[model samples]
Target: METRTVVAECIGTAMLVLFGVGSLVLAGDYINALGISLAFGFTLIAIAYAFGRISGCHINPAITLGVLLAKRIDIRRAATYWVAQLVGGIIGAAILFLLAKQVPRLQTAGAFGTNGYGGRSPVGLGAGGAFLAEVLLTFLLVFVFLTVTQKVALVGVEPIPVGLAYTAVNLIGIPLTWASVNPARSLGPALFAGGGALSQLWLFLVAPMVGGVLAAVVHRFTHQRPVGQAQQEQAAEPPRVGPWGRMRGGHRPEAGGPEAKGPEAA
Candidate 1:
């Protein structure tokens, strides 16, 4: 079960980087901000459906870190996920580079689409601006993820809520910080872009992870453990009563029992 979840996280993260960063390498400014956002949002949408059952479809390191800090997942599992996410990001970057090699006169576009601040920013925003944007955006993203994935009375298979939430987040954030709610999304790009991107990588990773942790902490205050964990605890506890409770000398009656003429017989 744990293996499946980890696998899903790795695969989903890879898919996200492949599409989102892939677009950056294939189409420079032509892909535009909105298109890039859609690539990310759509990848999340697709992953939600594909891996939701296995790992709740969390492919972002910031998200995983946030949830872990919130105490949703144990340390061991969270560490495994973080490792998977990093490896997956590197792989996705390599793949994007490979695909970029096929294009003509597209050298500049062949980056991993890494997120950066200052001069590397789409709008040339500084580190402070980028940090704030990442913090706010990722906070919203994680909060929405917690709510949408919640199993309410009428709400089941929470993929749509999460997917739509991501799309909406992207719509508002694409113009700013290129909407990197997920750190790994920004990381793949930096690996290829280097220089400015490499220098400013800290903000992209730190801000989003911070935002995620904040959201997760808030989530914990409002709710108990996840349904799955609760169920596991319940299952682990011993049953209250045993077969003896239901056997021969049980409560009042015996197999050949007669009223024995209660007080009236006396």
Candidate 2:
């Protein structure tokens, strides 16, 4: 990958952790879990549009794994993204850790926005619930991305549904497991929060990957289109207005090309 691409991924991932985790740690008392979900979801929208063309804006390692399993990206590139994302997560958490120390209550609180289950969980959810939540939530997020970003339909406005999907999962999963769904996102804060956050970290990591792989399989069966057919469809279609006035390929004319003037020779 190009250096610029690597840097974009690094910066984008860092911002995700910075804003997403920061919202939960700093303003969580004020904004609550729903607001935190919007923070992460909106941050995803900003980064996806800002750096999406450069590196596909896969700030989450789980997303990268899903895309890799879908064969949308090669193994080597996926590895590079993983490294960049992990480093970015650490950097993001380090910054959050430093800032959190300034607050007297947060300093001793040791939250750092880490994810956990059972005693560590906000609602005392056990291992099984947290594991299931992570898997199901990650699966939905990845499946939406795989489906929405395709060339067939809703071509240009992928970021909207993709971001909304993240928000929806967070909205439901926050109280249960703090909405992990991304290993790097979880690992970064766990390093700082330690204790049970570190001990229960394995569940966050393993379940999300399993969910991503399952999403990839489901995407292949439900949404995958043959390359040649896709190309032919694109050629047959004409550029038309999509959401937000973006140009996207629309269906071809029923009988004639765009230049054809007569409607049934009337």
Candidate 3:
């Protein structure tokens, strides 16, 4: 990975956590679940425009893993992106921690937006339910991202659907698991929240990864060929004769139709 790309990933991920988690920790009560979900969704849209060109704006580790499994990125670059995203999440959480200390209510609040289940869950969902929620929600998010990004028609506005998907999943999964579709997003707050948050961090990590892999497998079957692959396939085909020969029109390359073969010439 290019140094600038890695730097962009770091900054983008940091911004995601800063705005997304910050909303949950600082203003969650005022705005409620809808507002928090919008906060994360809009943050992703903004970062996609800002850093999408530089690093494809994979601020979330799950997104990177999905792309990796689809063979869009090699393992080494994916590893680099994962490290940058994780570091960025920690840094963003640290900054939130420092800022929260100034506000007594925010500082006293539990978890600092960390994801959890059972007693820790906002809705008291059990571990099995939480895991299933994470997997299904993350799968939806990653699948939307992979498909929309590859769709030629959605070019420029690709981020919008991905952002909306994030918001929708959060709406459905928030009360259950706090909707940790991104492991890096979960890891940051868990490190500081400790206690139950730390103990349950593994679920956040494992479930989203599983979701990403499932999305990748589904994408591999349904995805259209990339431009390079399409071009290579076109090149490998036998040369055609007429304007619509060997494809639509039934004009064979014989009987002076185009390139008459020696079988006919002889």
Question: Which of the numbered candidates is closest to the native, going by highest lDDT?
Answer: 3
lDDT per residue (tens digit) for residues 76-166 in model 1? 8778888888777777877777777787766643235666666666688877888888888888888777766543111345666666667
Q: Rank the candidates by lDDT, best first.
A: 3, 2, 1
Question: What's the lDDT of the predicted structure labeled candidate 2?
Answer: 0.84
Off by over 4 Å in 2: 108-110, 151-155, 226-266
Tens digit of per-residue lDDT, candidate 3, span 126-217: 99999989999999999999998852112388889989999999889888888899999998888988888899999999999999988988
RMSD of candidates 1 onward, in order: 7.5, 7.4, 5.4
How close to the true structure is residue 171 of candidate 3, measured as C-alpha lDDT?
Answer: 89
Clashes of each: 4, 0, 0
After the best TM-score superposition of candidate 1, give how far the Cα of residue 90 lies from its true spot, in angstroms.
Answer: 0.9
Candidate number of the best TM-score: 3
lDDT of 3 at 211: 92
TM-score of 3: 0.84
Task: Write the residue-wise lDDT of candidate 2 on 55-121 in tens digits.
Answer: 8888888888888988878899889989998899888888888888888767524467888888878
Candidate 2's TM-score reads 0.82
